[model samples]
Target: MVTDKDGYIHLVQYLTEHLGIFENSQQQSVTEDTVMELFEEQLAAQIIMVCGQNPSLTFSQRNLVVREVDSIVYDLEEILARVSGHKATAEQSVFISELSCLIKNLFDQEIARMISL
Candidate 1:
């Protein structure tokens, strides 16, 4: 259901770049939780795009979709944490790529489920 598959790669890149910023900054106002929240919002936006402003959806339907999205985000936190902590060795990079694909699949499945409902 993801119209743009490449967006997953971009999401990973965005996460890494922002993580680097937080790591290098001396005055650290931005916490990892803040970064994760922003990432989660971006992810939720992509997954929820299938709804496309359909005002007919009931509150329960919207809540169900959101809960599924939250589940996907929770499952992805381990990969995100690894990406944040690692120095990016070749093996780790490959692992991260695999994890990225898994993340994409999770999002796709959720989007498909939302569309079907």
Candidate 2:
């Protein structure tokens, strides 16, 4: 089965291309705050899109999804602050992998809940 981590790779690749999350400093002003904001927006948009597909989702369910996404984004802000300006590729990869796992778990739980109802 294709896991959320696999899907996250695709999602990150899309975000990197469209949002320039890893672009050179001269090419874009990629601050941690900006990256977090963009990421939150993208996550919200994706949630909204999924909710749109499942029109039976109640208001509380939608709110829960928003809350969860907000919590993750908040955590991401902290992670970004810690890792920002660090040039070590291995360290970055480790952080990214862990974050992706966290995100995948969140998505899996939320999507499972959504699917059950």
Candidate 3:
């Protein structure tokens, strides 16, 4: 969203100052703070669920998934930060990691198949 100055300005204005989070916002029905809270709650829930289901892959295989997940999470974090106009919290980082691990698990067999080729 922050790909350019105009776009960045628009985003910041909309999310930070214009999203009804501030008194200047004309629409108070939905604030940025409320939306952020909802997202946080959902992210926390996803992380909890995923972390509860630990993968049974080997050390090397699991680590490889983790590494790839990290890369994806980093990009996700960057995009989220831009959209929210805030840095990612530690909890969010954990959520991302757990989500990544779960995704890796889902594709573990496929990855193993490809690796054996």
Task: Predict model 2's lDDT versus the native.
Answer: 0.52
Winner by lDDT between candidate 3 and candidate 2? 2
Task: Sum up the clashes in candidate 1.
Answer: 0
Ranked by TM-score, the better of candidates 2 and 3 is 2
lDDT of each: 0.50, 0.52, 0.42
lDDT of 3 by residue, 1-117 (tens): 012235333433443333232222233333334323444454445434433444454567556544544453444445444444333344443443444444434444445564566
Lowest summed-lDDT stretch of 10 residues in model 3?
19-28
Best by lDDT: 2
- For model 3, how many clashes? 0
- Candidate 3 ranges with C-alpha deviation above 4 Å: 1-56, 84-109, 112-117
Residue range 1-117, candidate 2, lDDT tens digits? 122345545644543453233333344342334444445545566566666766776788777666766665665565466434434243334334455555645565666766686
Q: Once superposed on the true structure, which residue ranges of model 2 sit more than 4 Å away at CA?
A: 1-33, 82-109
True-structure Cα RMSD, model 3: 10.8
* Pairs that collide, model 3: none
